[model samples]
Target: MKLKKIGASILAMAMATSMLAGCGEAQTEAPAEAQSTEATETPAAETSAATEEASATTEAKNIEATEITFWHAMNGNLETVLTEITDEFNNSNEYGIKVTLVNQGGYSDLQTKLQASAAADALPDVAQAYNNWLTPYLDKVVHLDDFVANDFDNWDDVVEAYRDECSEFGFVHAVPYNKSTYVLFYNKTMFDELGIEVPKTWADVETAAKTVYDAKGISFIGFDDLAGVVEASLHQNGVDYVDATGALFNNDKGLETFTYLSNLYNNEYARLVGEDGYFSNVLSNQQIASYVGSSAGVSYIKAEGWELGVAPLPGNVNKAANMAGTNIVMFAQDSNKQLAAWEYLKYITSTEAMTKWAVGTGYLPIRQSSYETDEYKAYMAENVCAAACYEQAKDFFFSPTFDASNDIRNTVPGVVEQLVFDKADAQTWLDTLTEQINAQY
Candidate 1:
């Protein structure tokens, strides 16, 4: 809720007058893997131009103009950007395909309404969902492999990590839309005054925290989400959170991550977010020197007098971060509406449109080409806060998708809270939590 609340406030203030509206491996070879999964059938050598033209003509005739509804959880400035993008798509197309935008409050609200609609056989044409959230509704959703094979020409341009997340069993079930990753936001003023360099590794973080606390008597770092920190630490150490068999967070690497964070908190070098629940205010007031949070949180961080700096999260065994955000999934519908929805989906994810989306909102562009575009480069040049996120985009991973994903994700905070506040034994708590998660599987 703190994430949503802070983002909403900053987005609303800027809008005032205008709108109302893979856990797998290290993923080093993701691009090649993604390309291999795409359908690659091509016309034969003897195929003529006439044959191609006729096939195109026949396919065009099969698709009919229709209105398709899109349900999303974006609000405030995000909704405003979505409206503009959707309107542009609607206006540019020659087909009379109209996309209706529906805001379903937040992600949780959207999930509830989506489930209810599915039970009633009244799902929308398309909706936004996290990869894990699609597990229960796979039967009702359209796999995009055929669509990508025939229609989408820029399939290779999508970021590899995102492409992998949208795929399951060598098939793409969704398209990455709003995507982001974690970054370290720190106070440059404090770092410079205290003779502490920007942290580039876990050891650097410890040294900086100790230096700051010794000199100024303030907690050096505060994590908005303890689970997120734990996950990132595990990934940096080359460990998975879960797999086909069971939870892997109780392994030796997991214990090391827990011990690291516990030591930080116990030694007064770091703290979890407090009751006020806004790190921007905490940082601006000089209560803490830095925090690890989403890249989309740039608008929420207000370091008035001090120069705010953003960097990739410090690495331990390796440099890594957690990928966050949702994908656009089309629900099963009549051919006409499905075609219309696919057209809208392709249009929105196009390089030109996604450039606008990424620049307008703080979210990263899913397309690799979007990053090379002049517009995105200009925006990045002006707004340096998001540069590190984009730079570290390739070095990120997603949690494995499973039936108990939401439940498993929800269990983390309680386990982490016990470690941070109650001084619970790390190995015992993790072992118990691992058992509970394995039971769900």
Candidate 2:
């Protein structure tokens, strides 16, 4: 999917304007209380009949379900799979609730619309959101902790890391919907011809790069996005880019990551797709040996002449992959609508639904039980690349959650560009960028 980048300043301005407007309230006077009457003054049979009638009325009201709106950004095959599952939910449920799906283009467009809706108090019943992007609107979203504890039956089956990813400040604000991680996509033909082993660490990657260059006279690897490389590198080295206070990527670990990438780029061993164009073209043409990218991107990879191999990304200090994808959050609305939304959310994440999702799309299933199913195992046997994604799920980590997260993501490419093209010192550029990012806080 094409991820659209939005300016953090614009998002902040919209949120701020909405918050100020949301604070206004109207006051009303209370009516005077009437004198209390004794219950014994009423006839016993009349009271019983009145109580039965009220109970029946309440039951009828409870049974009358509401139609809720769900906003999403899925398209193509992803959209197809979601539509099928949604239809199943609508048809199988006993409740009178019905879900209407709305596609707001891609994730970026969805976020843009969501912000505007917040400003106008016109948000949908449920929407797709990233953890950091949704943090600012926590007040407008329903915390799912109480619902999970009381209603959801599959809470314990969810992966621990994913569960934590959906929570913030001790409350569950969202649930994992479509989740993915990074993996290495290599050309097996090139590896066998050059007698190179699959890379398991940064050192191994460097060695393989040198081997491929010496043998084929082309770039060894191509990065679809430099910012992703930077993020993964820092994570592998146990460095935090952002936290509660501010940017943390100006330190030793960050410098090491930038310097390593800079050396690779400076030496012509690796090329960023921003400069070299698409990885699919480069890999198929044998211009580069391999590239590390999102597991969900596996569908875009096309190898014409050789077998494609997918594996976990090489680690330096530790094994880590940046978790990529959005979560499903319910908007704060009427109780009936909220309950209906929760039912839909829970249904999609169920074992059967997630199994179908994982098999239909390359997205990782949120529930551990989804992996143990025979259907999923059969699917994995056919698609090895997707299996690698499931293997790396245990080590997946999320980016920082803050109001300025989009700003931080936007700033990453500049730092990488300076390091790769301008030949700027890693520490110096990182320090400057860190200060700029911290200023947003």
Each candidate's lDDT (Cα)?
0.68, 0.67
Kindly state the number of residue pairs that clash in model 2.
0
Q: Per-residue lDDT tens digits of candidate 2, residues 1-441?
A: 011112233223223221110000101000000000000111112112211211221223353477879999887788888999999999988897888999898766787899889778789999987765554455677767767776776686786666766664356667887776667778888899889999888889889988888888887887665556666677777776666578677778888876777667777788766644557557766778998766666666667778788777888887776667778888767666766777799899999999999878877777767866888666666676655555555566655455566666666666667667776666656676677678777
Best by lDDT: 1
Residue 56 shift from truth in candidate 1, angstroms: 11
RMSD to true structure for each model, in Å: 10.2, 16.1
Model 2: residues with Cα > 4 Å off, grouped in runs: 1-63, 275-278
Candidate 1: stretches off by over 4 Å: 1-58
User: Which ten residues in a row are the worst by lDDT in model 2?
Assistant: 29-38
What's the CA error at residue 158 for candidate 2, in Å? 0.4
**Model 1: lDDT to the true structure:** 0.68
